[model samples]
Target: MTEAIVIAAQAGRALAEAARRAGLRPYVADLFGDADTLALAEAYRPLSGRFGSGPAAEATLAAVDGLAAAAGSPVGVVLGSGFEDVPGLVARIAERHRLIGAAAGTVAALKDPHGFAALCGRLGIPHPSVATDAPTDPGRWLLKRVGGSGGNHIRPAPRGTAPQGYYYQARVPGRPHALNFLADGLRIEVLAVTEQWCAPTPMLPYRYAGAVVGGASEASSLPAATWTVISDFIERIVAATGLRGLGSADFLVDGSDWWLTEINPRPGATLDILDRRTTPLLAAHVAACLGCMPALGAQPADAAAAQICYADREHAPVPDLPWPDHVRDRPRPGSVVRRDAPLCTVLAEGADRQAALARLETRTARLLAVLAAKKTHPEEAP
Candidate 1:
């Protein structure tokens, strides 16, 4: 069987499962060896690292080599979250295996605050102003790491000089939206536009909460002029960067106006919600990287949403409760989960975005309630 390597922080399960759907045996390496991931993967290696920080490069490459050695000649490596900040490491991996997504240089250029800002300026895109130094009025700016993913890397700018590897961005007021698309270096096919919400903590106020895929209603909500501008922005950026495979362009939208914020050069959190194609998106991603843009299947009729269920308190050892079919990224039983850490993903579908999000809230509440009861009465736990 044809094989492919998948790597990410938590959602490698989604990629591994997609690879299987694409008729490819997947060799997976990620921080979490969740039960589902282990089952879906042909061979799994647990990488050691924090969530935002890409897995330690040496260990990751070693794991990749080990997986490649065990499997037949793999097609290529499909990366997900956690690699954006470490382009040198990405280049190292590309040396050994074909990378089935954006090149390391593309990631480096897009992740570089200054470079990306300059590109936006040249392209005449409405992007937030970026600077290495902190703004005089810190409250009007946000501090962000050079290559941060997830909302954990963002915070309100502080006084004085910006720290090394961090920069200040002029804060823009709007709701967060991500345009997930597929590209073949020159052109792109827009997949879905997801509305994103945040799960805020004291320290991580911008922590990613969830996203809802609104089909036609979402399209009608935005003005045609706004979409034209967005499409132009994507075209210009792709033309300049040669971005390939599955990627998402993030934007802040208020009324009819929108500002491009960031571009994720790989499949992102929305894969769970947007991977509704008959031909698996991973397959299309590989094809796109190989310069073939496959036709995307119809969008789902019903709205869908995916939310991260974060631990409210530390679970010394997570109880072995039966996880529902709607839940994903299930942590191993008896594993310790720190407070504020992601427990699992809760998914829901409904007739529309509001309904889908409402169902997500209910499912999240029910799951949390079960865990709370188990914590209070250990013997009552299943």
Candidate 2:
């Protein structure tokens, strides 16, 4: 079997599973060596890094080299998240192995706040204003890390100067939505538009919660002109930046008015909800990177949702409960899970978006309840 290397903070499970679906043996290295990820991957290596902080370059390279040596002529590497902040590390990885996604320059350009804002302006796309220095009206702006994912790096802009590796972006109005698409350096094939919500805490108000696949009803609610604008923006940005393979463009949408947020230049969190097609998306992603846009299969008939189940309090050694089939990215039997850290992902499907999200809520609540009960009854098998 052909082998591929998968790396990310926590999203490696989704990518590793996708690689298996694509008929590739995946060798994975990530921050979290979840039980499901270990099962999906042929070989797994645990990275010594935290989420939001990019993986250490030397350690990541060593892990990749070890995995590559174990496989029988591996195909290449498919990065998920955590490398966006350090494009130089990405370039270094590409030097040692073939990269099956966006190039280093592309990542650097898109992750650069000033460069992306300028590109949006040049293309006549609506984007929130960005500045390196602190805004006069700090209340109207937000501070964001240069190449942050998962929204934990965002906060209300404070008065005075901006911190290093962070910039201020004018706050915009609207709900969070993302356009997941596959690009072949020039053209793009949109896969799905997902609606995202936040798992807010006092300190990290914008931390990502989950996403639901947009169903037919949700699609009909948006005006046709909104899609046209989105298409135009995608076409322009792909042509300008040479973005390749799986990518997601985030947007703030309210009625027909929309503002382009940042672009995640790799397979994003929505992959869990959106990668249900007959043709494996990883195959399409590899083909797209090779400059051939494969015919995308039809979207799943039912709406699906995936939500992260964060630990309410710290678990020094998590109880070995009977995890349901719908739960994914499961931690090992006796592992430490910090408060506010992701414990596992709960997935659900239904007739429509609302129904799917409702099922997700029920599943999440039940899982949390189970964990709490298990904590209280330490000897319980469940």
Candidate 3:
């Protein structure tokens, strides 16, 4: 029997790819088991309709059990995007299998805005102000879903009673950057410093657009002293939280000060951008969880980028647009996707960050145009 790794997440395609790159077979269970992800997995299960009004943990556990039965005890379980809203469920899953990432306690603490803000204060890490209630000055604070992933639930605070799972964060100004790293529960190794941006729709003002790896010309124009401070800050966080596996720290770079934004304590979207064929990141994540640290090299100078393309209007993917080789997580034909739903993930590499990002945007535009045109002329779709 082939030894497989179990991957459960909102979207398992990227994590599955990471597992495959690491030379491990994956048994995947996720909300969207896209065609590509299904093809890549040794076995697959869909976690649809398991959790409606309740926490998703039940469905998540069921998925893991199903996958494990087929794969005969996976190496470990890697939880991706979807579990932020239910960290307790993550803890429950960990009890059954060796989780290849942060523990439930670490996740619970870091995900709580109020608790994390307090942690920042205790560690002397610079962080923006946070509150449970909506701020009187909506313009100065942003409302965020406490454990939301990908920037979908963040918006300018509105004047009203705060939502059940929402909190207010003082809006900080500067270029948004994300730091990807690997930790061994106590020590950390920084991987890549990336530029994060958003593509707003009618509903999502900060829909996660994409990220460019090696974005800064030399990993930020900030001086060595500033980077040293950031490094120390990350080390302190690792020491305090005992975070393990692959994770990324979101930050707002204001001049020389790097304001910590949020911590994604799981393998994130940046996995695609920073993936090196020779050094699959999932391997490092697995190693880290098992008390081993992989020697991660310094961030490369070459620029690579990944963008999530969303449907502008209700339209099906064009059947004959000669879909580029760089796209992943592609939707099935004639699926009748709704507006603002993610269509696919586009990737590009260039000599510099600007060039790579421009290429990705152009490619995204071309794909969207094709989808729109195909919708207008159904006969031309094929």
Cα RMSD, each candidate: 1.9, 1.8, 2.3
- Give candidate 2 regions above 4 Å deviation: 2-10, 50-55, 216-218
Clashing pairs in 3: none
lDDT of each: 0.86, 0.86, 0.82
Output the lDDT of residue 98, model 3: 82
lDDT of 1: 0.86
Clashes in candidate 3: how many?
A: 0
**Local distance difference test, candidate 2:** 0.86
Model 3 lDDT at residue 59: 66
Candidate 3 TM-score versus the reference: 0.93
- Residues 228-294 of candidate 3: C-alpha lDDT, one tens digit per residue: 7777788788889999999988889878767998889999998998877356899989999999998
Q: Write model 1 residue lDDT over 309-339, tens digit each, in one string.
A: 9999999898888899999999888889999
- What is the TM-score of each predicted model, taking all chains together? 0.96, 0.96, 0.93
